[model samples]
Target: GGGKPLAPKNANNAAKNSLRVADIGAGTGNLSIMLLERGCEVVAVEPNDAMREIGISRTKDKNIKWVRATGLESGLEDSGFDWVTFGSSFNVMDRSQALKESHRLLKPQGYFSCMWNHRDLNDPIQEVAEEVILELVPNYTRGVRREDQRPVIEQHKDLFDTIIYIEEDFYFHQNIETYIAAWKSVKNPYWDLETSEGQELFDKIAYQMRHKLPSEFDIKYTTRCWSAKARN
Candidate 1:
């Protein structure tokens, strides 16, 4: 049986009292769906055309407003949102500008939440996977390092007062195909490689992993969430 998925507890909490919420970089409306389910009016902002298409299709219920915009240019009204959230997309943003924009778009006491599912490098399989990616993929940018929380919070000290929550040992199970697809979706460096070479590396890695661990493949991740109310 598939394992139960872990949801962003912080985001869910923010949605409790929020009337209007914007999910920036909400690819395919993953987080947006949750907010909508919780009775918050959600706007799914994405810059990529394909991603926006996916989000639109996924959120056909007309409750979700899908907008093509980035963090720097959300195109929403100033002080228009009760909450703003970034789910696994904060690292792709210009930290200073995004924080400023987030603050600008929120009403007084509006909440801002950012969440990331971090791979636990302590696991042997996960460690080996990281090593393989670093070795095979050139100029790999590990997006955001695990240690970036302190500096990021410090940099935004004036925008909002911080509250940090960590959910450890969140388990995820994936079959080989699902694993490969999910990895390819978020791997920035792998996208740079030619299609043929990328496929080759992907196949090689999957083959090795299957041989190494034939049974159920499970990995643990730490879900880190930061939330704060906009400083008046």
Candidate 2:
């Protein structure tokens, strides 16, 4: 018999008044796909061409509508959505303006959900990975992008209420080769492959990965999920 994956999947029942969600700054449509699977009609607003293309190719569901728009200007209808969410990209946006837009697009009593899957840098393997990055990029700092959303969250506190924060640990296992490849695909890679300095740095990192890291290891992460209702 078939079964659910680690993430819960909801059956499609949109014909029967399913929830609607607008996933702003929906890079690669991961959040949109997940919400669509949960029986929500999702509008994925993205402004970047490369990311939008990948997201379009990855998600072909009828429930998902991809729009080339930023979080600050989603162009969604007023009070039309039951929820608005942002994944890892939230901290990168103008949070105050983003919240204002979120409030405008969501129905009263709807929720704004934000989450980040942060790597467990404290892990020895990850520690080494950071060291490798610093050795190469010299300025790679963990959580540099995430910083803190609290100030912005507070700045717009009047627009939302019933705030809640929850976190959980998750483990993803992969081979060293897969890990290396994944890192290479990361945006603004710590080491530039085209430059001689970057090549030298990558070579060093590669040597470490091949000789030191185990064939298979876990990449642990802490996922933080925060949700607040849209105030009337």
Q: Pick the candidate with the highest lDDT.
A: 2
Cα shift from native, residue 138, model 1 (Å): 4.9
Error of 1 at 141 (Å): 4.8
What are the per-residue Cα lDDT tens digits for candidate 2 across 1-232?
A: 2211222334433545667888888888777888876777788998887789989999875678899988897778999988889887676667788889999998888888888877787898888887767766677655434565556677787898777788899998989998886665344545666679876777787887777678899889888877778888
The residue pairs found clashing in candidate 2 are: none
**What's the true lDDT of residue 6 in model 1?**
30
Position 166, candidate 2: lDDT: 85
Error of 2 at 98 (Å): 1.1
- Could you tell me the lDDT of residue 96 within candidate 2? 80
CA deviation > 4 Å runs, candidate 1: 1-18, 138-141, 187-190, 193-216
Candidate 1 per-residue lDDT over residues 137-222, each given as its tens digit: 65666667344554665677788775555555688887766666567557355553347877787777666666555355787888
